[model samples]
Structures are given as C-alpha cells and as structure tokens.
Target chain A: MPRTNRQWSLARTPRGRLTTDDLALVESPIPQIGPNEILVRNTWLSIDPSIRIRLSSTTPLGYLPPIRPGEPLVGLALGTVIDTRNPDFAVGDLVSHIFGFRDYAVIGTRADTIGGYGLPTRIDTRGMPPQWYLGPLGSSGLTAYAALTEVLQLRQEDTVWVSAAAGGVGAIAAQIAKLRGATVLGSAGRADKVEFLRQELGIAAFDYHDPTLHESLAELAPDGIDAYFDNVGGDHLAAAMDNLRPRGRIAVCGAVSGYDGAPHSGNPDLFQIVSKELRIQGFRAGSYNHLEGSMRQEVGGYLTAGDMVYHETIFDDLTQAPTALLAMLAGKTIGKTLCRLTSE
Target chain B: MPRTNRQWSLARTPRGRLTTDDLALVESPIPQIGPNEILVRNTWLSIDPSIRIRLSSTTPLGYLPPIRPGEPLVGLALGTVIDTRNPDFAVGDLVSHIFGFRDYAVIGTRADTIGGYGLPTRIDTRGMPPQWYLGPLGSSGLTAYAALTEVLQLRQEDTVWVSAAAGGVGAIAAQIAKLRGATVLGSAGRADKVEFLRQELGIAAFDYHDPTLHESLAELAPDGIDAYFDNVGGDHLAAAMDNLRPRGRIAVCGAVSGYDGAPHSGNPDLFQIVSKELRIQGFRAGSYNHLEGSMRQEVGGYLTAGDMVYHETIFDDLTQAPTALLAMLAGKTIGKTLCRLTSE
Candidate 1:
C-alpha cells in the first residue's frame, strides 16, 4: 500500500453551477484502521447529480446527511478489500460502499473512515460488467425498482411515461415499467438518446426538443397515462400532470432539472390534480434502503435474462469526477457517469 | 304543490367571472312522476366554487358531466319530498340531494330532475342544526373528514395547516385535523375571517395578506408541518410546500384560486416537493362518496359533543343562487354558502 491516499475534498461549497474548482484534490496520510477494520482500494466511483444537493450548505430535505465542506465527498463505489482485521471481511473480497471519491479508505473505528451506510457489502458480478453493481444492482437501480412497486404501484394495464428516459434511474424505471407489462413511453433530450430508448429499451421514445412535450404526449398516449416516473422536473412534469388520467400516480425520484439552484420553472396546470384526481409525490432512493437486497436480485435477474440493459460514460480517473459530474448536471451525459480508478 | 317549477338555467357559459346574467330564470310545468318516482320541493341549495367548473363548456378533467347551456344548473340542496310512489321514499321526508338550483323538481323517471350523484337520502340531523348537514355532515364536511383521515393520514404528532380556513371545506378541515390531535394552523383572506378561524374554530390563524405567507408559516410551525389540507391553490400552496417536513402529505381538494377562469397566477415553489419528500395529491369530495356514512358519523359525533363547530352564509330563495355562487367564488362569503328556498 502507498503511504498516502489521494482524495477530492470540497474546496468551497458551490454557488449556481458546479465547477471543478469546487473540489480540491489533495494527498493525505493513509488512514489507519482500528479493530474490526478493513482497507479498500476503489476501482469505480459513481457520479450522480444528487451529490450537488449535499454540496449546498442548507441540506436538501429528506433523510440524507449533508456534504460538509473541507471533507472528502462520499459516493457509491465498487472496491476490492486489500487488508482486513475483521473476521467478517476477507482480503480480495469484492465490495461496494459509500466510501468512494478516494483511491483508498480505512473501513472501521474511525468516524470519517467507514461508510455511513453500514458495512461494505460483498458484490456478486454475475458474469456481467462489475460496474453494473454500482448501477442496475445499486442505489440508482433500487430507486427505480422500489418507486415502481411501492410508490407508483404500477399495474400490468398501466400506461407509464418516464421523463429523462436515457438517464440512469429513468432508464431502469422505463425498463422495469415495461417488464411489468405496462405500455411505456419515454422522453429524452437528444435524438440519439431517444433512439437508444426506442431501439435498445424497445419503448416509444421522443426527443423533448421537438416542439412541445405536451403535444407529443397527447399524440402518443391519447387515452392518458396511468402512471409517471419523473427524473426530470419542470415542463416535462407539467406535461405529465396535464395528461395524467384520474387516480394517476407519480414517483418523483429525481429532479435533475432543478439541481443547479435554479427555482423550479414551468407553472404546472395543477387544477387537473383535483379534476383528474392525480397523486404526485417525491421519494428518495435512501427510503428504500431495506428493500435493496430484493431490488438487486430482481434487477440483476432481468439484466442477466437480457430483458434489461444499461449504459455507462466513464471518467478515466478520480481526478475527472468533478468534470464528469459537471457534464451530468449540464444534461450532457446520456446514462450513468462513472469514475474508473483502474482498468479492467 | 305548485303547478309551475321555477329553475335557474344556464344562459351562456360566462368566459371570466360568473354573473347573474349568465343564468336564466325560467318556469316549466312540473312534470308528472312515473311508477317509481318522487317530487322534491327544495328548501336549501348549496353554492360551491366547484360549481364554476361545471358551467364551462370545456369539461374539467374528472368524471362530473359538464353543465349544458340552457339547462338547469345542478347543485346540492336540502328538500322535502312532496310526492312519492317509490317504496324507498315517503312524502314530507326531509332529504338532501344534488338536485338544487330549482324549486319543485320531479325527481324520478326523468334523468335531469334527480341528482346525478344518487337518490336523496333522508337527512339524519343528529339533533344539531339541521343545516349543519350541508356544512359539516354533507359533501363539504365529507371533503374535510376524508382528506384528513385518508389523504393526509393525520398522526398524533403531526402539525397541520389549512388554507382558506374560513371557507366551507377549509373550516371543517381545520376542526377535524385538530380533533385528530394535530396542532393546526390556518390562513384566511380577511381580518374577520382570520378572527373566525382563531376564535370560533380555535386554531392558530393568519391573514394571507400579511406581507408573506412563507414567513408566517415558518413562524407558526417553526419545526415544520407534517400535513397540509389545501382549498386555495396559488401562493398558499407554494408556502405550504416550503414548510412541510419530510414524508409530509397534502390533500388538494379544491383550487378556489382558479375559480375566476383567469389563468392560474403565482408560480408555486414546487422544488420543495422533491426536497421535502412530499406527497401532494388532489382529490374530490365525490371520490369519498362511499365513506360519507362514516365521515358523517365521526363528524356528527364531534358536533354533538361540542368538539367541532361550523358556520353558514345563507342567500334566501333559488333566484339568488347565481348571486350566491358568484359571491362565494369572489371570496366574499365565509363557511358554507346556501340559498334557502323555503322555511322548515
């Protein structure tokens, strides 16, 4: 092991747009672990736009702890156990934890060293890409899965629409709703993303830039949607509200459109809420933390059966995480953005 | 019984504000009843903001059939059965039904005379003011009761806020939430209305015109609220979203703010719907139609026990329905607005 661990610490809390200057890469003495400890060497780190909510001084509501300044940022990452003093963990065991954003981390007894989300869990690659553990079998995928079953309570007859359809959580949400025997519709920003949604995911997908989303949605689902899984907020949400049928359900799992500290735009036609008897609610991935085991198993089964697919855009090293996150916040990334610490 | 039935029919759907000119007072010979029929002489008629939705040519999205031009405008009213051939009804039985805005209605065989909701059920006044049935035990009361118990799911420790707290549904909603052991707060438009909310309803109340609702909400519920029952949907809704805690619930029963047919103004602060993990869903009183019996029983129990109270603003005679409805929608009336057709 090297004498130092390289990590990105919050240089200054961001204002408006997130820039690379918001984070500072620094060298620190390798953390020393106590009894019942394991050391991890991170291989891949996930960069999600939700991380921006934490970078703000006023923590976004819900249950997640705020990201503090002058501290290493926390995120999901797949890693290898390099050393262990704990009987529960063995050297060379593949694992995943919120101990990412650093090349190496000490796992126990030091308050800042270990992951807040319990112990690092062993990862089963299932002969698929290991990075899938950070996606389809991880927090983002669990979010889509739990939201469909618990929040939306999607039925086989439901006609569902997914906004931000090509994004990580939206991709899984669109696919899962389809697998549940729903008639699915999806909206993506770019033509290629719309193509990916239609060709790969096999859903009727449209680009949001073409005219108004409300008109396209009316043409696509003439009867109206039974449910909506919203990843992008604003006008896409407003359009869905306008078209949602009576007793419709919405699982607002993400609001990537408002992550830039901008006030939420688009005055939604809310009168339809009463007139249509619609139910719109917001939920966080962490709320489904207990169902992760079942979510992972179910989502993993579909991935192996070829009924599901996912995409990843990789940053070569941890140093590029800030840049990757910025690209995602700017709506440039089509799918999951990952920081690859080491090559396969 | 009178030889002629006088009713208020729609003249032309008003484009903006509803005026008496939009309604035509006409007389038709009372129709003869069929084998299974009843004739009702209306004594009271309800004037609700929701009535405006029906008068529009473009039907509001829910299941309620739109009011046709040149047809008697439909509403809820208390009446006495003047004649009956059906075993289900008896002559002179006090009843309530959605067969109002008229005097002398031939209620069987003809589709237009009978209430679209259902047959007139005999009113069980429970010894309180008989008119309390329309305010606290009728649809307005049902709206508040079901919204608190089923929609908001009020817990013992919850802090609740009721918008339009002096209005029909809002008045009952404020009382019911308080009975459920939740600390209650309300917002009304006028000083007198605010005083009514505080003294008569016995809840912490504020005037909406007081500089900013958001600041007042923060001051009222410093820790944040667990539930909100909204009758007004503009800035009041925006303020509620700003103050609700995580896992908060909202039951959007009415949007009186948009009753004027004006474009919905004041863009609501909706990002909090995501940040707060809020569940904001819209519902109608009729959606809880089946639960009316239980709601009546529960609400009646409170009224009899003096644990709950209600108010009514009466407009005498059917001719004043248009005037009454216009007044209620204009925010002039507090509590239930009823047009009295006859003395008990």
Candidate 2:
C-alpha cells in the first residue's frame, strides 16, 4: 500500500496566463483513519475553470471565498475506500468527494450517510464507465440540463447558439437542445473541435477565430437564433444579441471570454435586451441540486445507451491539474478536462 | 374652428442634442372624413425618450421603425372624437391613438374598433383626468406594474433601486414596489425630482449628478439591493451591479444614458452577473398587454384614492413637443412630459 500522499496547493494567485509557479506539489504522509472515518485512495481529479476564480486573492464579490496560499486546492475527485472504521462505507466501496488535488483522503463522517461535495453522489454506472459520473453526469451535465429546460425554457423548433460548444457543458447543451427538436448552432475555438461538433453532435459549428463570426452566424442561422446558451461572454454575447430574434432568451452559464478581468469592449448595447425583449439569466448549477435525479436518469441513459458520445482530455498524474486547468481555460481541451490518478 | 391641421415632421436625424432644426412644424388642410371615418382633435401629445430612438436614421434594430425625413413622428397621445360617420364612436368621446404630432386627425375606420397604436384602449377614467390615460394609467403605468410583478417577480422585504426615479415609468415603479412592502431607493437628475421621490413617493432618493453617487448608493443600501428598475442605464447600472445581493433581479426598462448615441463606459463586468446569479430581463409594456386589466384595477385604485401622486411637465402647445422631448431626455422634467395641445 502506498503510504506517501502527493497533493497540490495553490502557491500564489494567478494574474494572467497561469504557470506551474502558481501551484506547488508536495508529498505528505497519508493519515490513518480514526473511528467513524473513511480512508480513500483518490483515483481521478476533476479540473475546472471555476478554480481560477477561487485562486484570485481579492475574491470576486459574490462567489465562494478565495483559496488561501498553501491550502490544498478544492475540487471534485473519484476515489475508492481502501480502509474504513465507519459502517456504511465499507472496504472497496467506490465514491467521489472533495478529496481535492490530493492522492488520498481521510474524512470523519457518518459511514451510513453521504457527505455533500455535491457530486460525490452515489451513481450506478450500469456497465458504463464510472468516469461518466464525472463528465456527462457531473456538474457540467447538470448545468447543461438546468440551462436548457429551466433557464432557456426552449420551445420546439427554436434555433439555439451555444458558445464554447466544445466544452463539457456546451457540448451537452447543444445535444439536449437538438433532442428537444431545435436547431443548434455552436461556436468553438479550433477547427478540429468545430469538425467534432458537426460530425459527432450533428449541429452547425463555427470557430470564434473565424475572420467573420457574424457572417458565419448569419449563414448558419439565417432566420436568427431564439436562444443563446452563453458560456463565453464578451464578443460572443454581443454577436448573439445582434442575431437573437425578438423575445429571445440567454442562459448565461459562464463568462470565459472576460473571466481574466480584461476589458471586453463588445458588451452589447444592453438596450438591445429591451428592444429584442431578451431574458438573460445567470445560473450556478450547485443551486439546482433538486434536479439531479431527473438529469442523471435522462442524460445518464443517453451516455449508457451510447446515444451521446462524450470526449475528454485526461492527464495521467495529479501534477498536471494546474496545466489541465490552463489548457481548458485556453480553450485547448476538446471536452471535460480531467486528471487521472489511478488506472481503473 | 381651425381649417388646417398642424403636424411636426422630421426634417433630419439629429447628430447630438435634438433641436428645432431636426423637426419642422407644417400645416395642411384637414381632409374630409369618409362614411367609415372618424375625425379626432388631438389634445395632449405624450413625449417620451423612446421617440429619440425612432428619430435616428439608422433605426436601432427590433424596436419601432425609424421615421423618414418629412414623415411625422408617431407616438402615444390623448385626443377626442370631434366628428364620426362610423357608429361605434360618438363625437366628444375621449380617445387615445397614434395621431403623430398632429393637431387634427381624420381617419377612415369603424368608430367601434381600435387601431393598433399599441394603446388608446377605451379606458374608463371615472372622473380622473383623461390625460391620466397617458401617464400613471397609461403605458408607463402598465410598464411599472409588469416590471414589478412579471419581470422582477420581486420577493417581499426586497430592497429595490429605481434609476430615472422621477420619470413616468420609474415614479410609478417606485410607488408600486413600495406598496409591495419593499425598501425602495431611487435616483433622479435634479434635486427637485429627488425631493419628489422622497416627499411624495416616500422612497429614499438621490440625484445622479451628486459627486458621491457611489458612496450615496452604498450608504442608502447598507446591505445590498435585491432588485433594480433600470430606466437610465449607464453609470447607474454599473453601480447597481456592484451593490446587488446574490440572486438579485434587474428589470431593464430603457437606457436613457446612451439614447443620444454617445458612448457609455460604465457597462458592468459580465462575470458579476454569473457570480451573483442575477436575472436581467428587458421588457416593453406593449409586449405585456396581458397585464392591462389587473394593473388598471389595482393601480387605478391608488390613483383614484389619491394614495399615489403623479407629476408631469406639461407644455402648453404643439410647438413645444420637440423642446419638451429634448427637455425630458435631458432629465429636466419630473414625471411624465406631455404637450397639452388644447385646454378642453
């Protein structure tokens, strides 16, 4: 058994493009489980861009507090209980929790009930990959579901645009909107990802780097879009406003375009919101935990039956978590970005 | 009786501050009404900032169309039927319609059916002034009601901020929100307008020109506002975004700040929207005609009982319509700005 535990802690708040100097990986001894505690070996770590917001020292106004220097970065991870003094989590039980960037964790909790890392949710893979629990069935999946059904309240035959369509949430959002009988037009960064969307997702996809995004949007959605699932705010948002039909709806999932605190000159003349009668709603999926079961059953079925194909860029070690996040934020990753710790 | 009808026609689209040069008051002989026609004598012309958007040659997309050079400006107005060959309408009945900056209008239509100027529905004033159909009981009133009940869906005990607080819509909105038991803070242009908000409407009010607008907002809303009724949407919008509580709602009525086509630099960071989980909905009351009856009954009661007081900047004649609009746009007017075409 491995007694040494390796973990990454935030070294400093990142200013622009993140480098490894911003995070420090250190080796520590794995703590033994006490009574009513469970010892787990973390096998996978989920890397997300939201972690960058947490790494900001000043901490944005209304989001979660900043992670202090030298504190282990907190995020979702898949782990297996190797040893336990608690009754419910027996040896060899598979679970997911906020063991974070660490390779091992020992948490004191009632063995009979599950703790809330939100997605540590007990999922039945039903012969599918458990990793599906972290991607198509994780926070991204739930966010896509909520944005489509509740936020956008998409009507059949509505034309939709998904920004960051190559990402975890946007990819699924496009598919779900398509499933709801709407035309889905999406924007990604790379040509390969754009191809992936058209070929695999069967939707109109364009690259944001295209010289004429407006023309591309016009060609793709000639009649104009009825809904916009906005993951990239700035120019993408402005373009959507220009192309949105009257009484359009915008489900604001993320602001990746302007997340680094840079000037985004393309903030649309908000008057268009009234003139076009648009509804822009900003949402956090963690607040929609009530819809978890239904989303799991619906999106989970698509994953299980091979009706929905999801791709991910996975790193082999925990040291790659920071790099993975940078890559994802840089729009280099094709799907959900994750770091693999143990080979299942 | 006047043999000729005088109407103001657009001379040119103004580049900056609107002047008399952009509009020309022209006179034409009144045409005889046909058997199906009704002749109307225009009494009061409603002057709103939205007219500026229409006067722009490059019509701001999606709202009302632009007025061509030599075409009369179309808007809401209070008038009376003077001659009707049609059976449904009788001479001397107060009416409202889009007679368009004119002193007399003769139309060929069944006196019974209403035209779609979007308003001028047969309103029962019940001893209240018929011009009330253009102010507190008009589109502005319906706008306030719809914004509070439908757009914001404001929760009780909410702290609200209304920008352009002394104007037609904002004045009524502040009162309605207060009646709903919310702590309402408002911003107007002049000291007198601010005083009107505090003294008559019972809302905490401030002047936007105050050098300490940000400090004043912070002091007024010690915690944070839960909702915003945005009429002037430049710095006030930015300030509101900075001071909104989590899950705050913004009902975007208009953007008078940029109505003159000048650049406004105070657009809020889009990330704050996602972080705070705000819902910003833009609406026009014309689109929400469904709420007319309920709003009239409830708000009408307040107006009849004198529980709600409304103020207006009334111009004495048709020639003042252009100047009244410019004054209203400059925030020089309190409450509704109307050109009183005649004295009964």
Candidate 3:
C-alpha cells in the first residue's frame, strides 16, 4: 500500500484579481520511485512574484513556460529526502529541488539535484535553521551574488545603491556589497524598513518616499554612484540615472514596482544615459546555475561565520499560501515569504 | 612686416537666433612664432554644431571651458604654414590646427597639435581632397570609430541601427558597422536623406518620420538589433530599446534630437533597458586621443582605396559659417556641413 499526498493545483487562470478559488487542494497517490529517483517530503514552499508570469498564458519576455490548469504550481522549494534509489544521495539527507507545490514529490536524480549547479551534494545546515537555505543561502542569495559579481562586476571602492532593500534579493545584495568593502545605500517603502536597513544591516544610508529622490541621492553621494542593484523599477531607476557616475553599471534584477502595470508608461528619462554612459542589464538567477557550487560554498561560509543574516515571513498552513503570495505582491511582507506544510 | 589679420569674436549671447552682430570681426596684429611655434595662413575653417556649446556660458558635458564674451571663437581649421621655428614642421606645408576664427594664427609645435586629440604633424591626403581630412578622416570619423569599435564592440553578425544617418558621424558609423559585416539600418529626418542612405550607402533598410518607428524596426530586424549607434536621441532610443536583443550594446554618441530642449521632456523611456539588458555608453572622441594615428591610417586607407565615400554641404565664404551652423542645428544639411574659406 502507498501513502496519500496533497498538492496545490492551479484551478483557473487569473484574469485581474487572484482569489483562493484559483488554487485547489487536491489528493494524489504517492508516486513510485525509479532507479535514479528520490522521494522528498517537502517541509517548506517558497512563494515568489515571478510565479505570476508563469501563471499567465503569454508573457512579453517569454522566459518561462505558462502553468497549465489543474497542474501543480511549480517553483523553487526546500525539502528533506526520506528515500533514494541513487547511490549518491542517501536516505535522510536534506535537499533543495525544483519541485512543485506538493507535500511529497518523487524527483529523478540528476546532476542538478544539488543546488542545481552540477556539483556534488553536501548540504549541512549545522546551527542555522533549514529555512534559511531557501531565502539567503539559496536562490535569492545566488541572484544577488551573480548580479553583483558577474553582471555588474562591483569593485571594492564602488558605491552601491539597492532598491527594494528589505526584499529577499535586495537585502542580501546590499549585505554582499557591504561585505566587499563597498559603501552601501538602500531604499525601502516604509519608515520601519528604512530604519531596519540602517539599524540592523548597518547600511551606510537609507531613505523612504522622498519626493526629491534624485536630489537626495546627489546630496548623499556627492561623487556619484558606481553601481545600482535595481529590484524596484519606475521612479527609483529614474533617480538612480541622475546619481550614477560616468561608466556606471545597473543590474536589473527585478521590476516589482510596475509588475502589474504596463511597462511603457512611468518610464524614466533615458537621455542622460548618452551623456553619462550608463549600462543597464537584466539577469535571471537560473542563467547562472553553473556557479551554484562556489556560490553556495561562499554564501554558506558567510552564514556559518555570522557574516550574513536573513529574515523569513512564515505562514503556518498550505491553505494560507495564496494569502502569503498576495501579501508579497501587495508589498505587505518584509522578507522572504514561505508556507510550511503541516501534513508532511 | 607681417600683415594685419581679422578674427571673429563673440560679442553677445543669443537667446534664440544668432546674428552677425553676435560675432564681431576685429583686426589685430599677426602673431610672432616662438621656438616651438609655427605661423600659418588660415585657408579653411570648420564649423560644427559643437561650437554652439562654446558660445554658451555653461559648458556642455565632456567639454572644456565655455567661450567668454569678447573672446574669439576657436575650432579646428586647415591652413598653409608660412613660417616655422620648430624642426618637426616645415614652411609651405599644409597642416590642421585648433586656431581661432582668424585669417592667420601662431601655434606652439608640441608632439600633439592644437586638435584636442594630440595628432602628429604628418600629412596624408593622397588622391582625396584635403577638406575630406576635416570631415570623414578627422574628428568626425574618429568619433564614429571609437564609439562603434571600443564602446559598442560591434560584432560581425550583429544588426546595427544608426540614427541621424545622414549626419557626419552617423553616415560614417553606418559604413564602419557594415564593413565589420553587420547588417546596417538607419533613420534620417528627410525623404531625400533617406534615399541618399538607401541609394548611396546601400544600407539594409531605412525609415523617415514614421510614427510607427518601433513597429517598422521590429519588422526590419525580426531577430532583434544587436548594436545601436545613437546620434539622435529621444523617441529613437525608445524605438531602439523595443527592438534590441537581450544583452545588446548601444554607443551613445550624440543626442542631437534633444540637445536644444530640456532634459526630461524630450528623453525616451529607459525602463526597457532593464528588460533588454542594454549597455548604453556615452563616448567623447577626445577620450581616444591615442588611437588617432592608427584610425587615420585605417580610415584614410579606406578613403584612398575608394572603399569609403563621404558628402559635404559646403558653404562658400566665412560669412556663411553661422548660417551653415544654423542649418545643421535645424537638421537641414544632408551630410557634413562645412564652410569652405576659399575655392581650392
């Protein structure tokens, strides 16, 4: 006899507003493992705004495939393996996989099994909580790492400005730039988040909703900024353009500010790019899957040495997953938002 | 005894239209040559749009001191050496120097001459007209070369888009990209200029005042543009962004479209830069002073071999210099707008 499993499936396509009815809790029979497959009991599920694009029928960028109706909402998640047929992965070993929004999943053992970097599996969450793997030391941390190191090639003497500084990716990117001896400045929506960046992360400076954002930045960085890690677009980018030094680099990691609206309107004045010689680049974390080994080793060392810190907004049940995602979309959550499945 | 010489001095600042009264023709004694200096009779004076910046009290970006009222307006000009005290330069030799708008000039003989790029005192106008040195094989050609070769890193298989296609820099840059094996496309304001680009340069495609500029470009380059040499900014940049491939490179050479207007209103939408991962870089031809020797050899050889061609809208007398500049500012000139001091 096999065990039963519960998974969240996309019930319908979202038109305007997403409702709980868009997702349905369904029962599924436990899948049998193949010779190279492993059975994982997922403990945590990550909810990200990028999932909204996957839910749409068509996207302008055309990066990822659209999710089908009645199919599991697939994304990145943290899980622990209970059974494995592959010789490399032993039973009881904790792992992270690109599995679905399901409690238990039977995934084929491939080179991408460990950190998705084709590296050997060596996951040891010693004193820190396992959930940190999905937030800072995981996909979000890698995004910040690749955007700063590979894309922007940030220098030690450079000044870095990060938008959406309280979010999962921005928070880690600011800290990483700080760790590399850069003067770090950040922007957040609320006063508390601004205070959090200064008081908690020891960020050099932070601001919230200043109407003269460009002038404020010019005052802060009299010499001008060397690089910008943009998570929130729109006015933040416009302000950044005014403050960027000649030959400055901008890493376009996300545009959460105008994700729901048309991208044409509310764009920044780009004529300065000609006079200033600015470089704006967009990057997805998956494109850097090859660097996951060294990235994990470096970020994991930072975690163990108490050099990096991360926060998670946790939801208790799977049914609350929709609400958690909505909160993130509405900018109501402070950090990485995840749902903990109790029935696993 | 040396003859008395006349020079054009900046008399007053212009709010809109510039008049001959704005410049005063004053007579002064011809200058005496120093140990490292040479005396030359000015033969041809070059008039460019960049001179407008010198007339303003505030200097433009990447430029030196503004032209003070009551001082002579200065720029690059070709002349015949009448006397020389330096061993490197000889009498009766034709030379180019950054002399004031005067009939005779005394310039110091440094390794690099009066031209900002410190070019050597060698002459190589074999078979081609000497005036061609003032346009294509001079600063204009060097600007196009540096922006395309260094900044954009123009690749052979790329699709290149050049704005202001009939202007001095744009016309040459389009040819250079085409020579590098790129599929070249361009935009000109007038139908005649558009036909000139199509018939004369053999560009892949062209457009003129089309409201559907973005759609037209998308249709022309279905695979997306790989590089953009921007001479005109504003809506052209926005259209380029719409058609740029992921990781496309842009050389921001000039913003002639919005140079006369305020910054924000005439600027293009820059938010697409994030999605496209565009590298928009500004370059001053003066920055690549070291490459002048090799660039002159290369571009000069192309001109001599009949592999390259250029057109100039020549004004007959020194008095017409101001009108010629005004015509260039109004986008009325087809090719390089130059003032021929006297008939050859």
Question: DockQ winner among the candidates?
Answer: 2
Q: DockQ for each of the predicted structures, in order?
A: 0.61, 0.74, 0.39
Each candidate's chain A: what TM-score?
Answer: 0.93, 0.92, 0.88
Candidate 2 lDDT score at position A53:
73
After superposing candidate 1, which stretches have Cα over 4 Å from the reference?
A11-17, A34-38, A56-59, A63-71, A84-88, A107-119, A124-129, A261-265, A330-332, B63-69, B85-87, B109-116, B124-129, B261-265
Worst 10 residues of 3 chain B by lDDT: B111-120
TM-score of each model, in listed order: 0.92, 0.95, 0.84
Best by lDDT: 1
**Model 2 C-alpha lDDT per residue in residues B19-93, reported as the tens digit of each score:** 779999999998888896778888888888888888888765678888889998778887888888878788887
How do the residues A224-252 of candidate 2 rate in per-residue lDDT, one tens digit apiece? 89999988888888898899998899988
Give a tens-digit lDDT track for model 3, residues A1-344.
Answer: 33887788889887765667778888988888989888888878887777775665654442455777888876677777788887878888877776747788777746543225333243587666877777777788889899989988999999989888888888888888998899998888777778778887888555646645676687778888999998877777877877788768888877776664334334555655655667777777867777767777777787788887776788877677888877887777776888887743
Which predicted model would earn the best TM-score? 2
Poorly placed runs, candidate 2 (over 4 Å):
A32-37, A85-88, A108-120, A260-265, B107-116
lDDT of each: 0.83, 0.82, 0.74
Q: After superposition, how far is residue B313 of candidate 2 from its true place, in Å?
A: 2.0
Query: What clash pairs does model 1 have?
Result: none
Provide the RMSD of all predictions against the true structure, rounded to 1 decimal. 3.0, 2.8, 4.5
What's the true lDDT of residue A190 in model 3?
74
Model 1 error, position A171 (Å): 1.7
Ranking by DockQ: 2, 1, 3
Candidate 1 lDDT over B1-344, as tens digits, reads 56888898989988898888889999999888889888898888888888788888876676467788898887887888888988888997888877788897766644443223566778866566666777888888888988998888898899999999999889998988888888999998889999999899999999888967978888898999889898888777777777788889999987788777866657666667766679988887766878888988888888788888778899987777888898888888989898888643
What's model 3's overall lDDT? Answer: 0.74
